[model samples]
Target: MTGQFQKSSMYMEHNPGIVENGDFRKNLDDDGRPKRTGTWMTASAHIITAVIGSGVLSLAWAIAQLGWVAGPAVLMAFSFITYFTSTLLADCYRSPDPVHGKRNYTYMDVVRANLGGRKVQLCGLAQYGNLIGVTIGYTITASISMVAVKRSNCFHKHGHHVKCRTSNNPFMIIFACIQILLSQIPNFHKLSWLSIIAAVMSFAYSSIGLGLSVAKVIAGPHARTTLTGGTVGIDVSASDKVWKTFQAIGDIAFAYAYSTVLVEIQDTLKSPPAENKAMKRATSIGIATTTVFYVLCGCVGYAAFGNDAPGNFLTGFGFYEPFWLVDLANICIAIHLIGAYQVFCQPIFGFVESQCAKRWPESKFINSEHAVNLPFHGAYCFNSFRLVWRTAYVVMTAILAMLFPFFNDFLGLLGAASFWPLTVYFPIEMYIARTKMPRFSFTWTWMKILSWACLVISLVSAAAAIQGLATDVKKYKPFQTEQ
Candidate 1:
């Protein structure tokens, strides 16, 4: 305990922005901000990469379930809602006094700063679950993407059993090892280069999916007409329509759900008080970029496959013309997830490393600097604590992925759990409280109502998702050569 205090004091000395009570000292510049540094382009790239997760692949199916009108409506609604909430988060980055606040670096920091109480613990639980789930989700997504491409070209091509020894298990395990290595990145800000690559990969694959779907729609009979292959038609009174639309709400929310990491990404910028101006601009551009792709991919995918669209169009697209395009797109997905797994996991390591430092103050394995000296032919640095935490973290996720390899199921569950709270509820509620808006005012009334509505929606979606998990569990078989 004494040594822990000493280390804590040391950390506080070196990082004056953080205090013993986990609050910022008032000695910071007017609007509690550090260096104002990151560029808008780089920030946009990071947001784009973070926002366009594997969820976008499900947008086509989401559209099919929501029907043409409701589908596009929900997408646009989520887009605008997320953008607004993101700006609120950007404004919240500053401390109590806008003129005399230090930036809140992490999501928990924001929660602790504004709405302090037992809510902190609740926030921690939800945030950690969401982040870890994201890492595991990435592994699950990558393995499926790779397996789809490989099976198309190798396993199925060779006339082997679909559940043979060489199935998705090996690829999943390999990517888990890869994540262990990528998770070495010291902090969230350092992921700029990888985010750029990830953004391009997202664009590349999404564009291909859109283009092919458009081609199929054009080539098919009654291409210009509204034909729904029976399941989804103009009447829209299908048996499970309402439930499926709620499910689609979860998917759209998932695709638009990047708010959890928005503040962390903002901290990477180099401005005093981490200027909201830059963050707002980045948020706008990021949403704009993703919206373009989302609309194209979702529309084409729904039009081409109609109600038959699977939860993930990549797997559902089947072996169509220009087969190599599918392989290339899948390859891009694998690479993008590699970078994304690191982006989300970096913050988890931040949480873990902080706890470890608090726990084992004297151990050399855990350092105060959040940094390490890797003498790689010169001065390439690494964090020893990071090395340990990330390795174990990846291994745990890998094991889980191996045990239950349900890609969309896990995605839906995590999205339902975190999307509403992180993306919609917290941001607006925090904004209302911090700004001291009148509880009875028209603006405050509407915003508060919206926030509560979203919270309720999230709760319902979570219940539905959990109820479906029983089916997934029944189907999963660990270590079985075939799925």
Candidate 2:
């Protein structure tokens, strides 16, 4: 880190107007870009928007698999691990010196600065792959919520006993079309409003779920629950129990998967008190807020439905009466996912566009941005490549979602694939490298142990999720997923 600092300082000496905290500088950022105005509050909103996503909807089923004692315990455990490693990764946003060092714009940049070589390629593959999976998951989740709204009304009119099955394919198409428009928002700098709206929607649906679960618990006829979760012989077979427990771990792991885009989020922050400082504080607040909500939703939902808990409280038809409230909750979920798909996909869009611009520097199609004035709105810079590429990406994910709309399985697989590599291993390795901790030191050893343990967890979770996906695929045909 010190050596890198020397190189950065040398480069800064050669570059005149791009120095941080310069008195004689124009109203531009240290990178010679527009000034960043993101405060800790906006950063916190972004974190919350990313953290509390579709994964939260599956927590009741996850808790049902793990039972009462282990469920809440595992949730809290992931909360601690996520916050701790986030603080570590936050510091790496600036190399050599976290406060004054040159910025690493993306997660890949952080890895290249701290631990270069093949690790950078591996980090990109993991980060981008996980992002693709998340967007697909969000598409499926949003479609489910949309279908749930209609189903809730149907159940209310025709009674819960009627077989009111609805296909998710149409709804998935609807969500993809919505994403195609929102995906053209340019970049993260322009996404604060969407994220803020998404964050509020997340809170709205989460609070509604929690409130409904509490009501169900108080309504008198509570389902059976146990400290050890599902009974082996009655609720599930022995082998089934093991798979579900692992899948539950994966679900919880996915719920805390905001680290992949942490640096990107941090890049939006203004630095006077330092970007790393604000990001760390935002991470702490975001994780703490999500943890409280997770506990309430998971534990209370488990208490309400017990071993028979649905995969999603709102969309899985957990509540029937007060159908209007259920419809509102589902509507909230759909709105939140609309924003979330953009929050996660913007990085992919930016990365691909930047790379294209570098490769074909003279191409007008990819490089040109045409300014068009709207009736009431200001000038909008339109790019042809962005429209085509992002539209294709959205359409692809929606088709995939329509093919296999297994909600819990997809969430678990994405969580398992991303949690260890992007969330645990890379962050720990980069932190250790930046700090230059001795291999045999106590703290270093502990960090390595933690990373490896998470690896094992991720592996088992992946296996279970794969098995679950295979089972679901065998039962249903593609593009014909009915709720």
Candidate 3:
């Protein structure tokens, strides 16, 4: 190929649907992109996955430590902050001539553009580390979900129950490896229908779980507890200052998680008008739906568990009349988690592809067209990539999951730490520094306050979460049940 043809071919291979002029035009325009219609629902599902994660399972414990009133109150506060930050970041994407495409800047791009070149690279490194951590966490969760389901089935089939083990079951290990490798395929967008099904399953599972817990609590008679000797329990009484602060941090960071996808969602919209409206509509719908669900889960779970509530709400069932119902419920939860993993893992693949393309020009696998032919060129080439990447994902996830089996708590902390900088602080800072704004613009004021607030809260929550994790880590012994 001539030098010009080679360059053009490389561009075509990497850019896919985009033309040389930067507009999206290609033979297969819709092949590998998120759909625009029903995007509101998709957005809602994204918000739920971002917010819910493994956190939902352990929220009751976190709330109990803080107190019942404190827990839901914090959740609502976090919800509001998240909404505010998401809106501000979305507006940043609307600015003309953004660093990346107008609506496709990743978290790293936002930081690089605002914080100068060195900080951009630093932030990218931090984000890359974070993404690795996140990928591992999600993978571990997926594996655990599978294990939980299988164990439940075993109990159903045989009267004898076995303790959960995470050994080298060669068959399962191979199956998981295959699933991870297949998930890395470039054409996962072909499985977009899975996203829809995942979304529905998540909402349904949340609804049923919350409803059953509430009904069980209400139908059962209240039991009284006697005060223990000598030891005074930590204050259950609510403190507004602590409650509001924690709540604000949680809500803001929760919304901040969606920052990664905000620009992608905007790009997927049909036109500028549609994009703008969709941003506003999606933000509104996402916030409203999540707020309702969070409140319901928090309130219903607290009521059901009362003072005797287990640290994690999801695990503590008084006892269901039919044993099969509990098994079915566990299956629903496992399926919901599969959906959650799909949402979380998609971005990891995107990140890996972007990095591979940037770093390995000669590999040609970095180029889109070249990637399709990778499997055939050399057996070792394709297998090597698969083994290296998938192993990296699995190993990372196992380490993190083992280290912090307090999955839900770690998620909350992770949300607070990363979401604020990536979504709230960086975006608004970029908008102000990169684009001209009026001295007294309400938008500027709103974004500034939101960003600063998120920063402070994220710092505090991250510290607390890390401290909590360390404590739990010291107590955890392998082969013992996870707390």
Candidate 4:
């Protein structure tokens, strides 16, 4: 019994649990492990990355479909919902219990504990599917950016006579693989600095792009045009119902799909007591920054193109009045996207490393040789598996990009599916099941209502987005035609 207790103590020291009572200090050495400064920045950057993926670019089109008023309203609603749900999640982390401990409960664990095993499994599967879609979407976006760059450069030097096929080349595959490897280094502290820099760059690029887009739209000839007889240039006649369904699904999928990163944020922070405050502040800062950026981009994109907006913001550059702005926006967007990819890939690589170490005993190459030691051995193994897993990641990304080169619709659906479980549903469920609220308090009532609302919204939106994607696949069939 004494031996077991001692081992447990050692484990706790290595893998500190939830932040409660305001103790956020880490248990590991600062050499390679997470430090206070890095963890905060990484957490912030992760939120930004998750919030500002291909979705930012595509949302303009989605909003346009619903009309100017309805689209911006929905975006505002989404921002509020995200904020409220993230707050509830912070509350859940404040709960006192083994299950509520930091690094203990994944989005899956929280859902299962509150919603039931079945729901947990369902949500988990949905999240995984969403992640796959998101990964592919990022890859596709990267490819498109690369192609655009090559084509643009060629056009500048030799005029539009030369056709550039660089987007479809093998170099992108290699670049993505390299990115995955770099992200797998397992130094949260170091990555945090990168994330801050990335965040600054993303903010700057997004701001400039938004300003330029807005100016073009307002000053362009098409600013006052309205749809005649409810017809936008694109034909929605063949599959109106399917399109609507897909839209709703996309909303739900994207709304909470980003919640999984919360776990990563929690893990990187100093242990409970300290973790609690850091996480709340981090969540608040990150979510707020993301919301502002999304809203700004969405509004600008919608205003510029109105009903004619392309799914991705960058692609809509064709609508910009002065062609020079298009080139500038593309450069900013490309750099920002690269930063976004790095942030998004970090936690995923961490999770994979942990899982791999558990499955393979002799994979000491990850821990000792790679100089990556996680507080959790499982996490260490998963991180180590990066060398092997990265190849698969690259292959899958390339194949998916080839099959679905454009990710606007797919990203929407994925976001709706994953966002609810991770951000809204799981957090509320976890708090309700594990925490004791003050008797007859307004806070308790508000929380209950908020949780129920999130669940409902998540489900409805996910369904709609999925339906929308299915319709798009049927209508476009790019893969089939290519084959």
Candidate 5:
């Protein structure tokens, strides 16, 4: 015990910020940083903020493609898979021993610890690329919500037949501006309040959508719904139905694609109860909550609009009667996405900034932090490179969103690209490696089988999404997608 104390004292000499408590664990974390205050509740807020994003708004359209039985079944299945895999990932937040191993600060760090070399690079590419795609998708979705408010008002004032065409470019620009300001919030550690607000907004908009759908279902004639899916000849051709079904699967996958950032969220947790234990509980709660909302929104919306359900029920003008309520819901969606955009993109921002600082340590532009005083708020730490890079990143995504505003196609494609590799394959592989599960054993075989099945689903979803994008590209002109 004396020797251990001596070693800990020596370590503290170097890491001054960390001090050992009576339990021998540091008051501050293992890293020489401030003590983490995150509880299971904050972790749940982060997960909900990340998971219940713009993707949830598309679930109605996804269910429409799969019909009554298959739709709800698929939602429940994805929820279970996400929760299970997330628990496995939670165990991996620490190293060899889940409860007491060394900390991994980021998702890439976790991958590097378990599966090194080429796999690490692949994981980084998939994880960061998916984040970028998510930001772009959020930009498009937020703009759509903004446009929906204007269009809804226009429809209410004029007749339904009048063309209330509004260009999404302006709204996209406005969303980008808001993100530019929020992007300066530094890192994930400081985003708890924003995440909480976003979580509430997610629930609000989802509830509004659910209430509207239930009202529609009660009010009168609903669109035609089928048992299996879209009718072959009547609703769509056989080939189209196949593609739509696959795309719907992709949409569902995207809605559940928060695993990419799971480790980052876990890293925020204060440990005495252990980060893994807290994260597992948070994952269960977050996934269960979102799943309930998803089922209610998707199934009820499908019942209201059936096979013709809009890609985004709120923004798609499905509930046009209560114009004020529709406006409020869209406003909530836009606000929710504002925070969600920062949640996903901040990781990428941190990654780039860290790399730049490391590679160019002496470059004042990258390394220097300035204290800029605001009127009411306290002095803020500002970095020139951060401002320039993050603004450019937001601008680039905004431009891309304007160029390709095919909402459903983009969501499906992003989901298909990310679902297997980040959400399933990496977590499973890392878990297997960490556990050192014997090869070819029953457990090992089944895990591999699950991974392979998800891969197949991802591939088909990607193909379908590509087909849809191609079809939409032929119909709509870039930068001129008016609704």
Candidate 6:
């Protein structure tokens, strides 16, 4: 948020044109429900919901894989990278001053406008993958969080380790059913309340997690000595150090991977304080907010559990002690993921529906700015549309959740494959192309160098994640590690 990143906003003065003439008109959807209502508050809320979902659960586990040093260091590093790239994305929301001014509404639109060629098609693929991955990831997380709470409650109530009979797949599917109903909301802006509530929930769970970790670690006899001792918990005996390192990188990347929907988020802003400025402020606030919670969650949770930390921090708090807090935290997590699932899915739904509209405009979709009415092509068109695609996405992900409930591994794969291209590579390349800073020039050179580094990191991370999956397939055995 310093140096060249700080561009003077057009509304430096108290210009009524900028404030009064805000997104009131520019933001209306085809159905006239007023699409853009994002202020700094709502925008930051969306960002928090997008960036902080379930990823915080793995911060401790990731720290264990990377150890104290590399883990927190990499976390902070991703924070800076996310902020920078988000700003680059914010800057790209609108065209150059002279050209007809309009926001890029979609991620692919930005790429198509700036990079051109097959880049647009490529971006579309990456974006959809990232979006779908996140939706599935959230569902998986919600199920785990809910089940953990149930098990912990059973244990605490009976003063025994009660093996809760609640199944994981059913819970995931249940949440997906909820998502199918909630995700019917047409525009991203409409969910501002949902995102805000989710953000508050995120902070609640994360803070509770941090509180429980501190209490646990401090309650132990050798509390002060348990702090970061350079090589204290460094697992040199780990079977796959090289792969684990990259897996840790992918985990960090996933924790910070919210770039894919940034444009759609930018579109939600009502364009008063200027979308770029508002976006930058919102990004900074959101990242800063999440970073505080992330650092605390990662640091304290790792300190409390060390090498044995569960992938989900709340799950590690145990069934006996702090049972109430743990239950509350997990409940918050489950509720929060519901909203996050919807937030991420809006972009995917839009992409699919818009494409369908272009292909079959006569299908009675978006006939008005406010709503869409698909004809019952065979006496049940709406039901057919709902079942065929949206429901399938939830079911497909729920089935995957049944198979691979591991949060960190899922994060590794998603971050490496999807965020690699969609989040890291595209933003850097787009910025370089948009700025036209002469390929070999000093500024451009460094940007290119960073882009290459990010690319290599992404590829290595993906390979490590794939390797981990190959090894785990036989051993995982469907939700067996709850112990």
Leading candidate by TM-score: 2
lDDT score, residue 325, model 2? Answer: 92
- Cα lDDT listed for each candidate: 0.74, 0.86, 0.54, 0.57, 0.84, 0.73
lDDT agreement of model 6 with the native: 0.73
lDDT of 1 at 415: 75
What 10-residue stretch in candidate 2 is worst by lDDT?
A: 1-10
TM-score of each: 0.86, 0.93, 0.75, 0.75, 0.92, 0.84
Error of 2 at 223 (Å): 1.8
Cα TM-score of candidate 5: 0.92
lDDT of 1 by residue, 9-46 (tens): 22343445455332354433333333334677888988
Which rank order by lDDT, best down to worst?
Answer: 2, 5, 1, 6, 4, 3
Once superposed on the true structure, which residue ranges of model 1 sit more than 4 Å away at CA? 1-37, 155-166, 222-239, 272-274, 358-362, 368-378, 477-483
Residue 250 of model 2 has an lDDT of 83
Error of 3 at 427 (Å): 3.0
TM-score of 6: 0.84
Spell out the clash pairs found in candidate 2. 67-229
Position 302, candidate 2: lDDT: 93
Q: What digit string (tens of lDDT, one per residue) describes model 6 on residues 167-245?
A: 7776877897887777655458678989989998998988887887788888874322223322333544445656666
Candidate 3 residue runs with Cα over 4 Å from true position: 1-38, 66-69, 94-105, 111-116, 146-175, 185-191, 223-256, 316-321, 368-396, 399-413, 438-447, 481-483
* Candidate 1 TM-score over all chains jointly: 0.86
lDDT of candidate model 1 versus the reference: 0.74
